[model samples]
Target: MDSISFQQYICNLDPTSLPRVVKICSGVYFQGSVYEILGSECCLSTGDLMKIVDVQLQKVTCENMENGHMFDLPQDFKGLFQPIPETPGGTQKKPFSLNPFSTQSKTAEFCGRLYSLQEVLRSAAVRQKRLSCLEIGRSEFQLYPVYKVKAIMHFRNGVVKIDSTLDVEVVDVTEESRDVYFIKPLMLSEVLLSDHRLPVEAEILEAPELPIAFQSDWVSCLSKGCRVHIHSKGSSRQILASSQQGKKGACHYFLLSSSYKGTFRRCPRKFSSTTELALSLGPARKLQVVVTKDHNSSEEMPLFTVGDRLRVLSLARADNPSGMDMLVCCRDNGEEEEEEEQVRLPLFLEAGFVEDLRDNKKYTLSEVVQELQLPCEVKVVPKDAADPLGSVSILRLEAQIKEHCLLVSLANEPSLAFEIPPKWMDVPLFFTEGSEKPSPPTSCSKVEELSEAFYYHLLKLLPSNVPPPPRPPKRRDSKLNNCPEKPGERKTSAAEISKPPFRESKSQESAKTGARQDSLRYPNQYTIQYGPQRPPKPTKPCFQVTGTSASDDSDHDYEELCEEVQKTVHKLQRASIKH
Candidate 1:
């Protein structure tokens, strides 16, 4: 392993062949100064070893042929992805020009089967005419490998689908993989490579004393030869974390292991706009977008006013009348009942729109499968108003609502996603667009990294973590229960034993209270007021309790009514006595 310059080392390095460790040789200098980019040391530290996990192809600088201006296109910028052609024109083989034609394909597809060129020539009654279309006889046309290849071409007119035979160059869309050149995003990753991370398992050869806390036994365990898996997210040269080998949790911050030598995986970057997400996912359906702030009407911007709502319907269309890539959006009709108007604006719209907030209507995750479409814009809202989703705005659920669990990611940040069970974390959401049925989310990403704060929030809300409510103190036993002098002797009479010591209340006389208690003992003998009684409440539907809503709040009203009735009875008695 000869030490080479970082730029030279990764010059020809393929992104597919990543996770390579390159030890910083002596001090790599940038004009006698340390090279730092994005808070990451650019391999300038002396003796610092780093893992080049992955490199994401973000923007490709391409010189425009029309104006010679440098423009950048994102890696997933709907550039090109087509299938292989029947005949591949190798570089050595020249294509046909005006009045001049190249050799047709050697093989011909006939009756759903492939035939040799010689067999087709022999069967079709070969002719020597240089006609663009091959014809044997009248009403008989065999496959001449002519310009019958279907192609989709764009020009002043809208999209035109036809075979490339009308004196036109055979524009095969299948050559994007080989013909198109992709500029490498950075010195680390390759173009159009599947996601690959270097999850390395390394043993701590030498441990730094300051990284791990002294209070925990983990500090002692961070000794030489201690096996630990390094969770180095992203290709940052600085040490991120280390944990017990084979375990994903109970991690400790570890910097400069004794002899750590392993490559690192770069964390996926976050996407900021709905258009970017829609472009990544071809033919995205139900992508719901919410306007976070009001945008004033301007000539450059779409006709978006303060209160108007916008719904992105499709990806940026290059076939606009203005020739610019315009994002296709549906503008909600303001107060007036008008049909949704189509709006086309620049793809890189600088409007204040927050992703993930769907329609204003709120729905729990339980209703997702039955009620919502996939990839809808939404914000995770607490069932109670007091609890808030701090720093968390609207969330985009770009994936499917699972059978038991669902993942919701930040609308603005697509890379960071968290999974929560529908049971405990079934959050309600209002659509950001202020519509009835909300569109889906913009991001095509599934679950990614779960936020540590959100994880702790869920854990705290778990039934095991929450303590039960305190039970009311048990009623104290009465100390005034009378007992016979001699338990073994004759028992007291029933009347004496049954009698309870009575005290006159300040509001009532002793004789009257005793008589009232005696009358209460014989409920039938108690005097009944035969005064005018209010009629029983009507058994109307409004009075009837339906569904699960509680009617217990009305108990106070019932108590007040009872008090009013008692007051009337007492006033009547007083008036009769005075009279």
Candidate 2:
């Protein structure tokens, strides 16, 4: 070696001593130490000491030695440690020597190669690889990248699929739109936070905080990445059983829907069923008496009165009992018996039971009698008779025979029955013209005519019942005289004419006196006057005083003179009469 420097020799050393001799390489200083190493700022000896052997050095220069291997050297010593030829004719380069002084470099190089090999083996083992069936559990399984699973479906066995591919068919698709339910999903992480199994308790936190979303499919993944799947073969049949049990309990109250049952509870039976039966009991049975006439002979009979007993026997068959067959005894007194003959009579028949008659149907008297069972013989008693005044004739047994012949005739022919009796019907009487005096009965053909007149007079006696006729003129003669001014005209003042003096001729006065005397003699006779005449003047008498002195009686005489003066003045008024 041609003067090999210690720094050059150290630069050719390997990095196996890097761990133990890095401090020594830093402390040593050699020539050409100012040249920079590629990775570190330490001298060339320090870089060589830190270098790894199996990790090929980058951006480094090398020198040659007698061996065939190349030795790493400092980039600044490129000209000095050039490779030496092995032989003159041979093309082999000589390898650099291992310096005895660079023991730390070789040791550093060996430890670096061992650390790099360990890092490479660790990276190779971590690469992704597909798992075999043995690596997974004893069951067949799928490995999803990123640990993300969408849904799961469990079969009848304990086996499950990650995403099931079965198609669902519905019997009636229209029911899906008509009946729908709202579904909500929950995640495993959210369930852990709440730690509450009850639905009411979980509602305290809002549904959005539960990390769920709505989906139309049967299988879905919840918001927190939890898988939710519908397993058709699983043991979820308990839900249907609970729903059916709830419906069975609700069927016991079916009586609430019936309309007929509701009405029966609200209404009474009497108002609903038998209303016509209650209205049929109207008037009761009694005795009645009346006068009769022969239909063929047209003859009248005497009046019947009270205390008479009438037997009303039904002519009905024995098998049917239409009404009760009873005898009625009359109890009217003498005055009532007299009234019975005078009063208008009513047609009487045996009363029948109403139940036998159909509604709105007419039945004959014989038919009704046949329905009610009664004795063939009936008795009718007059009020004045001793033996209970009853009928003994066979005519009374007939069902349709008239109770009273006159009454039945009157009911049929009212015009004939109202005929006036001879004495009681009419009589002549007098009445004043304007007075409210009752008029005596006048002759009329019928009793009804007289009764009408009696009612008219009775109406007049009651002031409130009758209106008054117009008043007659006061002066009858003045009306005949054709005077322009009416007689008895109202005077302006009473003082103007203190007395109404009459002006009559001597002959007229004498005739009037004679008529007055005649009216006094016969009070029943009425006097009649013909024409107009003035009223008579009142007379005053002349008195004489006897055996009195003429001078002493002079004042009395003066009063007589004044009286005579008044007479003279009135006498003048009589002479001025226009008539």
Candidate 3:
């Protein structure tokens, strides 16, 4: 019989109830334990019993058995697979070697021929018992083998919800094993849910259009031509905006939310705001007057004396009473808008003779008033009235009369004004009535002659110690020109006839004595010498003495006489001298 048939038979019979002698393909083996029975059929030792079936199954499959065949089992098969050494008597057994055929060369040879008919049966049965599991669709739950239906159904209702209970065996044909199992379903849900129904395609309604109501309040008013509009509420009270023109005026309108406002007001004429008043009234024009001296007419004359009373009248009032009143009162006319009025009093000259007259031709009335030292008030009594009227009336009446007002009435006419003529009353004068007359001035000719004679006499009386006047060189022909020559007389050279040696010697001696005396008196003291002492010698003697005087022994006396002679010669000398 074939190995498949034998394996079928062995599988049909239960191992526990098997008879002692069993017929396999090759021989009948005595059955003891399951291991012994399997080992004996495979021709292997009991030690390798579990693997014997596997080795035999491989051999049978590889041969693709045609019919029952006889095979030789190698000798020493028992020695080939010696019993694996036991672990410590009570400990768990060690895992057997996976290469059951390579247990030993002897065991391999012997078991190599035996067929694995029982292994094929056992594998086929195990395979048949395996259940498969598959993942189907979106739910992600797994389908178990049909054998685990009860457990799966229980898990669906949550009765049997153990994590590991679906341990059904599954055979994977692709991998040749029964290994994996499937788990029950896991479900997920959304975090939050609402009961209200949601709309799918409702039309969006436009909000009702709001009417823009512009609000404004009067914060402040702007004058004409203002570009800024004031707002009632904002950070700043005013703001700038586009200009708006209306029948009333031009103005600006601003939004309420603006923060800035204009504060400056425009001037009508910014550049010409300030104007300058008149700076110049032109150069001042001076007043002119003519003054003359007076000599006759005592009553008409200016009666002046020291400490005499005097008064003055303004001639500006001579034309009319109003004029006279204006002059007397000295009221200012307020005609100019920007100019101030200057008040002034009329002037008068006191009763006094002329002390002095200034030669000023361009003297003004004001200057005359100042020069005359005139009083402001003068009492005048009409010839009819004895009592004195006020000064003002007197001045007014005097201005009307148009006649010269008497400045003073003195006991006597002052001598200072005696030279003034009576006709020149208009000519003002300052005088001294009681002042003494000044002495007369001497004649110029008489003074000159007196001075000349006095100086001549002084020169004559001067001491002999006085220095002599310097002399110039004489010409060679001077003597010849002045005197006539005798027929036999020889003309002497000017150098030979210059001076007598004796006289020069005496003059030198006198000079030496005077110098010695000066040195003796001053003695070793330092004296400053300033100019040249001596002049160059003259070409000729300047003088020719006509007569000799006695007492010539003393050198000083000779020097004195020589000086006198030199003076006389100077007097007679020609006027023309080279300066």
Which is the leading candidate under lDDT?
Answer: 1
Q: Per-residue lDDT tens digits of candidate 1, residues 1-579?
A: 344433323322344544444444543242224443334332133443334444432233433223444444343333221111233563322222211122344323323333333333222212111111122111222222222111111110111222212221111122232332211111011101224332223333344333222232333444555443221222211111222222343422222211222212111122354335344333434544556545444444555644456666654433433333455678766546777788765543444554444345555443532354433444445444433222223443333212232333333343333332334222222112221321233432221233344334433443441223223222323221232245455433333443589776766787788778644432221111122334544532222111233356754454454455556656767877999
Per-residue lDDT of 325 in model 3: 13
lDDT of 3 by residue, 101-169 (tens): 323222223223322223323332221221111211112111111111111210121212111112211
Residue 512 CA displacement from its true place in model 2, Å: 2.1
lDDT tens digits, residue span 435-545, model 2 = 232222222111011123333343344335122321322332321134243376542323235556768999999999988864443222211121132464453333322
Under the 3 Å rule for N, CA and C atoms, how many clashes does model 3 have?
18
Task: For model 3, state the Cα shift of residue 28 in Å.
Answer: 99
Question: How high is the CA lDDT of each candidate model?
Answer: 0.35, 0.24, 0.23
Clash count, one per candidate: 17, 24, 18
Please give the lDDT score for candidate 1: 0.35
